[model samples]
Target: MGGSLVGRIAAVALTIGSMVCARIALAEDPCLKQVFGRYCLGGEVDPLLQSVPAPAVSQAAADSLALIFPDGENQLYVLAFSRRIYKVVRAYGVSTQLRFDDTYRLLREKYGPGEDRSQFPEYASTPAARLAAIRRGEGRAVHQWMPSPTWHIELSWTRELGISLSYVANALSASRAARIESGL
Candidate 1:
């Protein structure tokens, strides 16, 4: 009888411990609800565009909504659904080259060197050529980093387009994400 009671107690203790651990893990999911100033990647989408700030201009597509904020020439673009964010792009406008440099410096300081760097050369012979190359999607550079197992960040730049940042969530499976994203 004593042995049976001890076994039952151990089982109960284990169940309680497991429940506690599960709660902790769920509470600390690294897929940040907010990564940038106030934007979250891969979570419930904001109801209003003004949830952050009124965009200078906005566009919508079948799968996404884009907002452009021209404040400070930091032309920020955000793509989100009514459920989650899929992509974000922030342009530097006129200060494309300078912003690109500053963004690289900041990323290095914050997250160390990126895991992968894909940089295209600027082969343009003239200023117009460089601009043309950038417009043609040439001379584009991207540095990617995995800040956490669930979150990935990409810093992209082009001579003519300036700098931008992107964040993605990789923790959820496609089917599961689709369900959550669809509010099902």
Candidate 2:
């Protein structure tokens, strides 16, 4: 009877130790508390909007909104249901005098090298796959960073779209992100 009790206690201790190790691993994320400009991951949109200067309507979807900065350097997108900042897109344009290189340099300086930097031209078979691809920053070219399990930053360069930076929420379902991205 005493041997069985000791075994159960040992099992419980091992489980607790495993949980602690998992938490430590999660806490080690380099950019877990990092922010982009004035915004951070998982932040509410309304307050951020209120704090910043008014933005131009770059695009308005049925359930999402993309607001461009006055300087035309960046775009902010917010998801409807949660009203959270879902994506921050930076557009490179000669007229706006924006350069993707500067942004790339800044990101590297801030977060160091990303976890994955690759591109896959093949289209995904399903919406889920598409979202996964997007999350992985898989496209014509991709530079991706996962600051935390809940947030990701993807920098993609394509012939059609030029170079753009996207900060996405990983916790949200791929379907939901697809819907928001597509404005469906």
Candidate 3:
């Protein structure tokens, strides 16, 4: 009878310890901080934007909306669906190789080295040649980081859009993909 009581006590302690550990892990997750400045995934847009000045332009679509704010030469785009922010993007007008490298280093330091998913032709072996190809719209430079299952970060450069850093909510993206796959 005493042994049964002791076993029950031990099991309760183990369960409580597991719950505490899980909560701590979630609080320390870096991806939680990777969302838009003060805004978070699945959070409402109005409350989050209250502290910031009004966006320079706003566009709405069938299911999503975008708010564009000017930041010097760059543009910050906040995209949302159902009034909840799902993605944030900062686009730099001057897309130089140096700028791309600097941004890449900063992101690497914070999130560890991301996957370099740049696509270049066989002849574009050197860094300079790759940059030239990208400028000519023949290739694209992409670096991606999946810090957690719920968040994704990508830094990409293209001739049409220049250099942009994007943060995406994976759950929202998966839902969009599902709709596309189902042709709905």
Instruction: Give per-model TM-scores.
Output: 0.61, 0.52, 0.74
lDDT of 2 at 130: 45
| Clash counts for the predictions, in order | 1, 0, 0
Better of 2 and 3 by lDDT: 3
Please, what are the lDDT tens digits per residue for candidate 1 over residues 1-184? 9999999999999999999999887665333647656666665445446565677777875645677766575666666654456555666656555666788789889999986575445566665565566667775667888877766788876655556677766543354468568876
Question: Candidate 3: minimum summed lDDT over ten consecutive residues — where?
Answer: 28-37
Displacement of residue 113 (Cα, Å) in model 2 is 4.2
- List model 3 lDDT by residue over 1-184, tens digit each: 9999999999999999999999887664323434545556655566545546778888887667788888789998878776767788889978888998999999999999989898998889998898889889899999999987777899999887799998888776677667657876
Error of 2 at 184 (Å): 7.7
Computed on alpha carbons, the lDDT of every model, listed in order, comes to 0.66, 0.59, 0.80
Candidate 1 local Cα displacement, residue 152, angstroms: 1.5
TM-score-wise, the better of 1 and 2 is 1
User: All predictions: root-mean-square deviation over Cα?
Assistant: 6.9, 11.9, 6.4
Q: Give residue 137's lDDT in candidate 3 (0 to 100).
A: 88
CA lDDT for candidate 3: 0.80
Candidate 2 per-residue lDDT over residues 47-150, each given as its tens digit: 65565576655455554555566445444443322455556656454311145467667888988987556555467656455445644656445678877677
Query: Residue 98 of model 3: what lDDT?
Result: 90
